[model samples]
Target: MALSLCLPLLAVLLQPAASLYNCSSQYERTPDNSDIIVECGTHTITLEINLCTAQWAGFNASNLALNGNHNNTQCQGSVDDSVDPPIIRYQLPVNNSQDNPCRQSLQIVDEAPDPSGPFSSFSSIQSVIITGYVDTPRSDVGLISYSTDLYYHFSCRYPLEYLINNTEIVASSVSVATSENNGTFIDTLKMGVYNDSDHIYPLVVPSTGLELRTRIFVEVKAVNLTGNFHLLLDHCFATPTPYNMSQSEQHNFFTGCSVEDRTTMTNNGLSTVARFNFEAFRFVQHRDRAKSSIYLHCILRLCEPTNCQVLLSSCNARRKRSLSPFGEETNDSATVSVGPLYTAREDVPNAAAYSNNVAPGKDDVDVAGLVVGMVFGSAAAALLVLGGWFVLKKYYWVGGRSQAFE
Candidate 1:
């Protein structure tokens, strides 16, 4: 009985100590080239540390305007016979990678996780978009040279002051028009390339000034990307019973209790820039079934660059009616479902399965077995000594009985 009890005790005692040495680390960077490194150690080890650099890529965003047409009461595009709105698409470019140049030492939690709230994480976003307009009917003289503001006006339910302030959201803007020379359609001329935040592209000429209305195409580039940090194995416990498990499991409910640091990024010193310039310019003449109304299409392209690995791209839309060629804005609303965010590369490639220092130590299972054996041996020796003492007492008692009989 003693040996059996001690064996289990030895096994339990040796198991935890053998499973030690757990840890994790992460790196984050901002647009301005600043960095934050996080590391946590579970067991003790000392040595030089090294980490590889990661890449940073460009981010993208959508205008979320109902229909690309700013059909508000202010300025409006021409009205058309058909109900379908016009089309407007935007694109943006992003950088590829980020580098990690340093390392640090840290300590991490080693105990088993609590049933609830053991880890927590967060994400930081850097995004940009382009906003511009195209006018029809060549506003200026028949020469096709027109001077006006390429206004893009739209409204959003949420405040958008920050989205509008970034210059990188607006790429280069230039005019494109077909030129006629010697009774033949010759090359094209692009001009009026200027930046105007108050509202305008400053186009000197419209495309095909002859048509009562012209189709102007403005290219808008947008970026919306993110970074995240994660932490693990922190203390977490369910609030004592009597509370509804379903409704109260949320992170907002618990107070004083903290969560594990799963994934996180710093917002300071990191800047996001969005710029767009009219990359392509074209004008279309009014055809049959076309009317005074300008078809405005607000195309939303949503991309989730998961953990900066694979990407998920989708599109949504909104519509508006421009009162002027491209001026007046409309109160129309639109929502785009970009879908769930993508997951990043969580695991490092080809990383060692176990720590190098851990290899030097003996196997945990072997050590456990040895400890169990020793515990059992001690218990057995004690039991044997007790049995022998009992036997000796019996023998002495029998001898004393015989002597009395004699």
Candidate 2:
């Protein structure tokens, strides 16, 4: 009996692992499968498995994706025949973007360092999770959609920010994954100038010369951010030269207040796009220059979607009632500086022209017309009265003379 058992075990070990697959259903237990192989690299996760295993289970490896979220990821297939049973390999890139192309999830975990903890280990770790799914759809089950979708999730984790030794692991090709970068958060936030209040037409310089009181529509947007963050404008001001705030700074708006009441704005804390408009103006100290450039700098904050609106409302309310200690405000703010906004006091309406074309909605009583009408009416009334008196006198005098003649 012992000899027979030993012979059977040797035969089983010699057999190809692919032919021994005993998949219970479409739901594959990938991690437990001795045939499936995985290697976690610094920026990539690669997986290889027997194609026959997937084929026999009525699932296509090409159709399987990292997260089952089709928009975020797609699988490409390649075959290797060096071994007895052919294997399919997928190189999954660990990436972060508007669409997490690999559909990797992220987590931050705190860890207590062990006594033998290496210097390279961190007290807290951030990890990227990679998951793949093999699903089988049964059409016989009337439109219940995925009613028979048999799938199981298989995943691996790499605590990011830790250095890795690439020499230990070998690969045929090394495709670099786009790592999530918070370093250039400022670069991703863009500020722009527009001509129309609706932000339709762009404000072109030289062609559309900056004149005093020219409405300049401005917009700041999150261009490459995948997370939802509301942008809040703490203050926006213009200085004479680029980045020299020590020079005369002309403030357009501050803490939600339009300083001169000459600005129009949308809700800053409710959208990723923060927008406002102020008339083109010259720096006070640089007003004498033939042409000067205005540097616009804005102090802004990016807040979580949950707290932005309420926080903005509270701060603005305080600002409206009275000035607060501006420096003591919350700290997660970023500053953006846009320079060389060539502004020359051109196309300025002279005082005389301005007075002549006074805007409507003013009490403009015409004094000259009133005086002319009054004088003409009085003179006509007096003339009529004098004529009536003369007529009466003539009548009386004529009658007396007739009596005397008689």
Candidate 3:
């Protein structure tokens, strides 16, 4: 009984201890080839170190050193040295097999705090110096040399002004054009009196004022993108309400008249300009000869390309239209199915298989005929030899002419 009790206590004591230090790093190059920036991060801190070098250099994580100022004495932070080794220890030229020149950045993250725990928050950090060593050898010492010392003088937290100033919408480049019959042909429509700076396009109602089934095309342009980002239109909706209402209020009023399309943005230029195009169906309802307009609503979001499927999971856009005057207001929702965004001639279904199954060409037919003729000629020659042997045997043995001549 005593041993059983001791076993549980021993297991609790033998449990593995959690790590206390983590660190990650990324590299970037300036446009003018002036400096290479190294971005390093831990659980609580991030640092950007600039090195003035044109050639690629190596970084050894084992040589990393950090000093923190506490009570006028410098304390060295202890990093967890038991982690697995990183795959890359050196940066090389673009033509080299290991590194990509076009990729100007790298990012790594450490999950645990330093062993010394010098930092409690961004404001608590006083003076810290991080030194990194390059893997290159020195001519005299025959050892690795120090690259640069990065000093942290400012607050560790990212500035609020940088976030606000870095991202903006390009409103001037936004435009719209409509194509009839699901983009089969282009039929430009005149801008109605309702066209204004805020709205994407004007809702033009024909003289008949009946429900005109037509396609609406919207194009949005955005710039100043950082990292791998993709643009998406959440959904398009139309309501029988006035246009003066707020976007949130309008969405609540026309909850059931939304359409979802599989339209994704394309990168038009070098990661700077993003172009988005989507087609929506509009039904211009007429009430008592006065043209009634349906206010359209759409949601746009920029997200990491890999997280698109996760972001779209909660999207409640409906594809099928309701038979009732107002479309289905039920909570049931589904995502629209779509083919590949870009299609090539070779990507067509059964294209290669169909070509292979086609009848043989003239040259192929001629070669096949020659092979068949050769096979038949050989069979005929064998039959003639057998018949000659049988006839000679019958004449010599049955007629007995050879014995009379002797």
Identify the leading candidate in terms of lDDT.
2
For each candidate, give its TM-score against the true structure. Answer: 0.17, 0.43, 0.25
lDDT of 2 at 333: 20
Q: Pairing residues by index, what is the TM-score of model 3?
A: 0.25
In model 3, the runs with Cα more than 4 Å from the true position are 1-211, 220-227, 238-295, 313-406
What's the CA error at residue 399 for candidate 1, in Å? 5.1
TM-score sort, best first: 2, 3, 1
Clashes of each: 74, 0, 2
Which residue pairs does candidate 3 place in steric collision? 24-108, 26-106
C-alpha lDDT values of all predictions:
0.23, 0.52, 0.29
Best by TM-score: 2
TM-score of structure candidate 1? 0.17
Give the winner by TM-score: 2 or 3: 2
Ranking by lDDT: 2, 3, 1
- Per-residue CA lDDT of candidate 1, range 129-212, in tens? 212222222245566643332222211111011111011112322221212100100011011112343225542232322133
- Point out the worst 10-residue segment of candidate 3 by lDDT: 158-167
Q: Write the per-residue lDDT of candidate 3 for residues 242-315, one digit (tens) a residue.
A: 33223333222111123334433332222212233333222333323234434443323333444444434433
